[model samples]
Target: MIQQTLTQLRELRLSGMANSLLSQIEQPATYEGLSFEERLQLLTDSEANDRENRKQQRLLKAAKLKLSAHARDIDYQHPRGLKQSVMASLLQCHWINKAQNLLITGPCGSGKTYLACALGETACLQGYSVKYYRISRLMLALTQAKADGSYSKALQNLAKIDCLIIDDWGLEPLTAAQRNDLMEIMDDRHEETSTIIMSQLPTDQWYQSIGDNTLADAILDRLMHNAHRIKLKGESMRKIQSNLTDGEHLE
Candidate 1:
């Protein structure tokens, strides 16, 4: 009878439940205290939880976040800029649900990318699809996709994601083609999907970095409005870590 039940569970693709049942059979004492209905309920809950865990794993794998960052790991102890209240609000993910943008600007190693990845991880944990890309690499990939005649398809895929994290925005001057490509991406995602941009340049200098006046305005119009801004103000986090390491070594 138990073998038949295991076969039925395997056929139904309830592997989690099947495994739980097998464990119970292997060590009957483990579940001897539970009633029949309680045992069934426990197995059912295990199956549901297994499915959720697998789904979350797939989403996190696809997110491609640079750091293994989480909302809780955010360093509020060493003041970067914004208050804990601001981070708490953002962590709630209301902005992502509302299809807004988030801009994180600061000098190199100022923890901008880390914070962005942390938010991206949060989005993933919330069951939102996410993709991470450095601006230069992303443009290159787009250019190659265009060469392969998959540019339209690429944009469509990006448009469907719940959150898009673009690191190193405005790192270099943009060509006309790059400007147009960026405009298309911003236009497609605007008011539809959320975006997180990490940049070293201040917001005011973005227009100059974008190069083409008209296209620059169009891109910024889509990104800047209806977006939250976070400017990290402090020395490079790397330098701080290095100093801490030196102190530890001396001790």
Candidate 2:
């Protein structure tokens, strides 16, 4: 009986050690020697870290669905850096009560899309919902929804997100019907939620691209009213990175 009791105690101690080792492997900063309070802190930290990583992964997946094709790897320290006002405005998005809009305009490869995605991800991280979609895909989706008699449901879903990013505006001229659908969305979201628009074309040319004088005026009025507008000016990061890689290979 004495031997059996000793064996049972030994098994229990070994099991405890195994569990501690598993915990350490899963969370490198935690260990068996920690005090009770320290252990609680470590657990909290582990959970928070897991949550943040998961959030970033989900946001990246949603951005991919919109064909963003880039990470929110914004370099705030560039020579021709983002304007201070723009950065401050983006950080203050949580305080915006009226569904204000943000517009980013630049030539090709000027980081317009990247900045917009980064801002949208910021809104997501701050506990607000976000949806990112390309302008072309948005129009096509509306067309299909109209055909299938699901247009109202689709619009409802779009309106629910806290922040919506419409990318690649002015890539192609919109038809009259397409313009009307876009106006409906903008009007619905104008006072209730925020929006981000990334376009390569200047604001003055939007009337020509959207194909409706009234919509062009109304949409621009809502979007520009107390809106934050940023203009990006820089060469294409892709081309620069490619050239750097080629130079390193030659060396």
Candidate 3:
């Protein structure tokens, strides 16, 4: 009878509850003292938690973040000008709810990508969909979509993501086509979704990098209008952690 009930639960797609039930059956003495209502509540909570975990895993896999980072693992001792208060607020993900943008600028190897990925992970945990891209790669994708006649569909899909993380921003000058593609993407996401931009250049220099004054203005207006900024300053974290640093020697 118990095996049949477990089979029924699995068929109904309640694996969490089924597993919980199996555990209870195997250790009857542990749960025998609990009231029926208490046991039922435990099964319900397990199923809900299991569903949430699966959803978060799907989101994280879809995100494809460059780094496997988490908010709890962020290095606050790196002297990179990151503020605990600001990060705490951001982790709550209220800005994402309001469709606000985030700009993270710093020198290369200063943990900008890590921080951005950490926030992206947080957004996933908070039940928001996220996507990460390097500026060059995203431009390549859009160009390919145009050639494949899926440009419109691609833009629509991008517009639906709750949080978009663009890493390596302003790394190269934009071509006219890339500029137009960026304009389309920004226009679609403007005021409707959140974007986190990681750049090595200062915000003021982004205009020059875009290469077209008019398009730069349009893109920046959409991206910066309601954006929060973080500027990190310090030596390269990679250099600091390298085994070949000045005093470190190989035996």
Q: Identify the runs in model 3 with alpha carbons over 4 angstroms from their true place.
A: 245-251
Each candidate structure's TM-score, on Cα atoms with residue i matched to residue i, is 0.91, 0.72, 0.95
Candidate 3 weakest ten by summed lDDT: 242-251
Which residue pairs collide, candidate 2?
Answer: none
Q: Measured by TM-score, how close is model 3 to the native structure?
A: 0.95
In each prediction, how many residue pairs overlap at the backbone (N, C-alpha, C within less than 3 A)?
0, 0, 0
Query: RMSD per prediction, one decimal?
Result: 2.8, 7.4, 1.8
1 versus 2: better TM-score goes to = 1
Tens digit per residue, CA lDDT, model 1, 133-210:
999989999999999999999999989999999999988877889899999999999999999999999999999999
Tens digit of per-residue lDDT, candidate 3, span 166-249? 999999888899999999989999999999999999999999999999999999999999999999999999989787866666
Best by TM-score: 3
- 87 Cα displacement, candidate 3 (Å): 1.1
Taking the tens digit of each residue's C-alpha lDDT, what string does model 2 give over 74-167? 6655544477566766766653455778888888877777777667666656656778889998999999999999999999988877788899
Return the lDDT, model 2, position 81: 47
Where does model 1 exceed 4 Å of error? 243-251
Ten-residue region with minimum lDDT total, candidate 1: 242-251
Worst 10 residues of 2 by lDDT: 63-72
Off by over 4 Å in 2: 1-72, 77-81, 95-97, 244-251
The number of clashing residue pairs in model 3 is: 0
Q: Order of candidates by TM-score, top first? A: 3, 1, 2
